[model samples]
Target: MHLPEIDRYGRGHSPLHRLDPRLKLPALGVFLLATNLTWKLPLAALFLLVAFLLTLLSRLPTNFVLWHLRAPAALGLILAFLLAIFTPGAPLVGPVTREGANLAATVFFKILASFLYFISMVATAPLFRTIQAARALGAPEKLLALFLFTYRYLFALLDRARNLSLAMQARGFREKTDRRTYELKARLYALLFLRAYEETERVLLAMYARGFSNPRVTLPQPLTSAQVLRGLPLLSLALLLLALNFFW
Candidate 1:
């Protein structure tokens, strides 16, 4: 994970970072599940507050979490706009209703809380350990494999695109809003696609030739008392929130 790369912010060694992935994964999972499931705005807000605090505890730079938040914030705004306009209720403002605004706020809080919790998990924890944790928890191997490969190929495709752009620049190519430019850009894209396919095929063949398997990984065997203690605060809070939502 290098700077300017996606997931570059995904490395750190705070206490949360050092917690066993086995314990960490479920605790975050519980928090995420509870945050999304709660319907009350206050509860949702509380969940968001809690997640933000936990993100701070993760000790990754603030930019690490904020950087991942841009897309989700944009999405929440779009949903707010659409829902506040379309969902019918007592009129609150021009086209927006009180009920619609409330619903949108609920969604917004949930989305932001979920994103922060994910950042806390991903920014601090090692990627391989997280995958292994998922595996140990009985996640389907096929889905995990698909996710792993897709994440890896994002870098591959980006590198491929970057190389093509560099090659074009080296050859004195310049963009113009013309048919010639469109045709050349299309050809460049086609070449990149062909290259990707060729690369994939070569990798697949090499895998078959060498008997490819998942990278050898050994998850920590014993969940330590310290790990349990570290995980409990979040897990307990998640359970309490769920109970508040359902039973209070």
Candidate 2:
């Protein structure tokens, strides 16, 4: 990915960004656990409130956060309506009943809450750092390596395709052109696919030459006490939401 795009969405100078990636990830996992396990509307509301507050603290745009949240929210909404309709329950809004309705509402809201929180975490934390954090949290060496390579090369391949497209356009590849643009575009795409495959093979060979398959140990960045101290409040908020669920 371009550094600027990643920096805008994935990393920034904020309390959330400064926290060790490893800690933030696990804290996120725990947040999801509490949200889903409790599966209560009140608990979900509390989690969303805290998540909203964190977005402010992290200095990410609300619109950007909403963009990521929309997809999961849409799916959750569909599932919730289906469950509420089918599950035996007292009538809620419309024809839906309340008995099993509450359970469906709880599950749906929990999923939405968890998705939004995770998206916020991603927006404020660099993907690379998150992967490193996962490694520190004991992700398998092979998986971690695969993650890194995939991350790097995925964007690299996209960049190459974009460049190729530009070159084609510059060479008069357009709808108005007399030549068959569709045929040309297909051949261009096929060539790109071949090139991409060849490039991938070269990369794999280079990795093999470097003994990437062999077990190797590498140190992740050290976490500072100050970083943990900052993250502690976020974790506390997650727990506090769980606690509040009991009173509700």
Candidate 3:
């Protein structure tokens, strides 16, 4: 994984880290809006340039973002190539049609913007803070509840899988084990799935017994107007650049 999972995401020390997740979350949303509002490639490039600088300012290593980009890069390359071949617009080069290539370029930029926005958000905000911010931003209660359950259950699922794997190893099963070992592995996987399901059910029943109705995750108080005010300058600068791109 690009990050060390939950730990790397919650550094919480730098200025960017210390800023309210509420601000960070909206900043990312505005950034996305700006990214899409302009079709000018150079303008989008500038947004990316600013994002690059922010990553550095946030004290995250370049690879921290780049590592996460691997999946996006692969997906983008595939989609770009397919769009270049199939979609029609302008000729890119001799024999290769222009229309297809131009649309492909647009797709690549769109994907890049999405990837950068998502990865940068993940790198800077702790998972819990991000969830809290999402809730604060008026995310639906149903969605919030689902996210809460998912966050807790993911680690639980992983722990169960690890235990199952260890039990198999203890039984003298290795990759080189015979065909019978294959059956044993399948059974182990079945048992793991069953265990995870039961555990989730148990958790739900326990929560219900405890009067859990709405999601109960705690977040530090919502960001004040003054706190949000601090990011205004940079946000304004970003919006200005985005606007200029269309006219210039």
Using TM-score as the measure, the top candidate is 1
* Model 2 lDDT per residue over 33-143, tens place: 777667666767777777667767777777776766677888888888888888775677787878658867787767767876776676677676777778788889788
Q: Write the per-residue lDDT of candidate 3 for residues 49-165, one digit (tens) a residue.
A: 776666666776667677777777889889978877776655667545677666667667766776676566556777877887777888776787788787667776777788888
Off by over 4 Å in 3: 1-7, 87-95, 98-101, 163-192, 204-214, 241-248
Ten residues in sequence with the least summed lDDT for candidate 1 = 1-10
lDDT of each: 0.79, 0.74, 0.71
Q: What lDDT is reached at residue 96 by model 2?
A: 82
lDDT of 3: 0.71
Ranking by lDDT: 1, 2, 3
Q: Which stretches of candidate 2 lie over 4 Å from their true place?
A: 1-7, 159-196, 206-218, 243-248
- Model 1 scores a C-alpha lDDT of 0.79
| Residue-wise C-alpha lDDT for candidate 1, range 57-157, written one tens digit per residue | 88877775677788999999899789888889999999999999998898899999998888787667667678878887878777777888877787778
What is candidate 2's local distance difference test score?
0.74
Least lDDT summed over 10 consecutive residues: which range in candidate 3?
1-10
Clashes of 1: 0
